[model samples]
Target: MTTQVQSGGMVNTTLMGGGALLVVGLGLALANLMTGGHASFNSGSDGVTWGLPVVNYVFFALTSTGLTLVASLALTFGNKAFYPIAKRCVFLSLITLVAGFASLALELGHPFRMLFAVPLNFQVNSPLNWMGVFYAVFLVLGVLKFMKLHASDWDSDTSKQVGLAALVTECLAGGMLGMAFGAMAMRPMWYGTLVPLYFLLTAACTGGAFALLMTYLTYGSESAMPEKVRALVQGPLPAALAAVLGFTILVMGYQTVIGLWSNADGMQVWDHIVSTPWFWIEAGALVAAFYLLVSRSSLMVAAMLIILGLFINRYEFVIGGQLVPLFKGTWVAGMISYTPSITEWMLTVMAFGIVLAGWAFGEKAFNLSDAPKE
Candidate 1:
């Protein structure tokens, strides 16, 4: 009854799991509202905690940004190698960007202020304010691109130019968050030259992961992609996975080093994260995820584990980054211990739900599983 795409390499069930995960993530939100985050965040105990919700913001941004990068490689650059997946990449990037925004909104204590304040008040120093500007510009350009897709006269040179311009703006806007991290002179943890590149590399992996899952769900195992897609994905996916893994180690290794010598905040964070047993759990999951790339039997298991690793990475980053004595002098090793509060946790769960629901809605809106036939 339905149309066919690829033929027989992927397992149909993996796609099913992807759908189920969407539900589970969403379902957790409802459960959280009913039962509560179970983890309390007393402001007295944790300080005015921002929690992992912000990390979700970063992750969502990574996902969207990565998709945008890959899409650009395919479309604007005229890379025939990437064309098969270009459309899906663009649409998926859009989906992830929206989800990231949703998560950020949920995490905010003053969401209404952010929404209304920027346009009215306009503070440029605030990264959030700049992001608002970025988002508005990107959204307008994106609409222009979307319009080209539906327009009968899209083949006209003017329309193509508009689409191309939109894609470029999207990438720049999408990269804003990543650049923000790298450009922070005050935060030693975030200031590394490689941090922005790290963001881009991980973004590609996340985007590829999303595409793979989408393809699996729609076509189920037998994707008879053009030779270009075949080569690009086969080489690209593993490369991304490896780069991300290496970047995680580099970041963590520096922390471990800092903790041993200096009483720096990042070092202090290193102490907590490394000292914990869950550190191994996180590390092990990442290793296993990368290892699965070479395996034929259980890519799904590995993918699941990698996703778990990603979550732990985010969790550690969120919790560990704040645990450091931010305001206190270097002599004070620990001024904060962070545990997510019920509100923070609930918001995270809700954010996950929103992402899943949004993705599901996204699938119906665009043929996110299909790329342009090269």
Candidate 2:
């Protein structure tokens, strides 16, 4: 949902709206648990195990990592122009990571068991295992960095050092998660070096777009942006967004051509994607968002579209990747049909609800509207 702001005030209506969303989301999540969430997976014979919760997890997690990187531009790299926006970015990064973790907890069969097992047992060979480790590190570092940022000695050297550590850890965590998918030889659509590279690029782009949208929504479109925030938005952010979007388009095109030509099972997964309406929606949104981005016209619209496109991109990739029948015995018509159950939808809603509630909390607790001068 697009944020609403008026006359330098974030609308109370919007806050109420977010609250409403949270209530509905949480209610559905509770209902889902009562109904036995993942038990429904056995009803389908398809190999597609990951569903809406995973999609929600990927979307929030990628944005969180990207938002952290944006914060580091000012916090770690000492970019004065980016400083005004750093606090908001850092705060959002933390909230989104928390939201992602919540999704992970709900997705797991035994949530508490995962909490103990992930740290106690180390799997050196598994990217997913490494992903969990790094995710935990990122969360710890992020909280420390956020605290240091809001502290009285925020500008001190120690704060900067913590910021740097947070930045490095966040990048590593994001890369490892990308590698988790890229390393999946069983999933042809996500395999190889390209997927990881594409993941990072999209993360950066999503972060930039999200920051811009949040800043605009925070300050209200009618109000003037602070000079520093405006500079950062106009300067490096646009460049990063354009470069990443362009490169991703190129990568996608290459992947598509190779998939069609190679005729290999992994590459041929593109054929299934081509037939899906979701794929077209994802592609169209990306192209339209890119056009809006480069033109610098209707930026709020562009940022919203970009974020939507990224969300859809993650959704399609997660779902479409598993659509091709990996096991012929369980598949119907060479593909598994998956329409996320009501429970799955509820879990996704809950993930977003966490984000909305987190923002509301930050607005009050952290004074999210005001960026203090150094």
Model 1's number of clashes is 10
**Reference-based lDDT, residue 128, model 2:** 80
TM-score of each: 0.75, 0.91
Show model 1 residue runs off by greater than 4 Å: 1-48, 146-167, 179-187, 191-194, 222-261, 294-302, 327-335
lDDT of candidate 1 over 283-337, digit per residue (tens): 8876776676554334445555665666676666555555654576655446465
Which runs in model 2 stand beyond 4 Å of their true positions?
1-7, 40-45, 222-224, 369-374
**On residues 1-374, what C-alpha lDDT tens digit does candidate 2 reach at each position?**
11222234453444666677767877877776768766743224455778888888888888888898888776777766676678878888888888888877877779998777867887798878877777788788788878876674456888878788888777777788889888888777787876666777788877877787777766665237655556666666766677778887777777677767776575656777677787677778778878877876667777787777788778777777777776576436576667787777776777767776676667667755444455
Model 1 misses residue 18 by how many Å? 8.5
Which residue pairs come into collision in candidate 2? none
Score each candidate by Cα lDDT.
0.58, 0.73
What lDDT is reached at residue 83 by model 1? 54
Model 2, residue 190: distance off in Å is 1.8
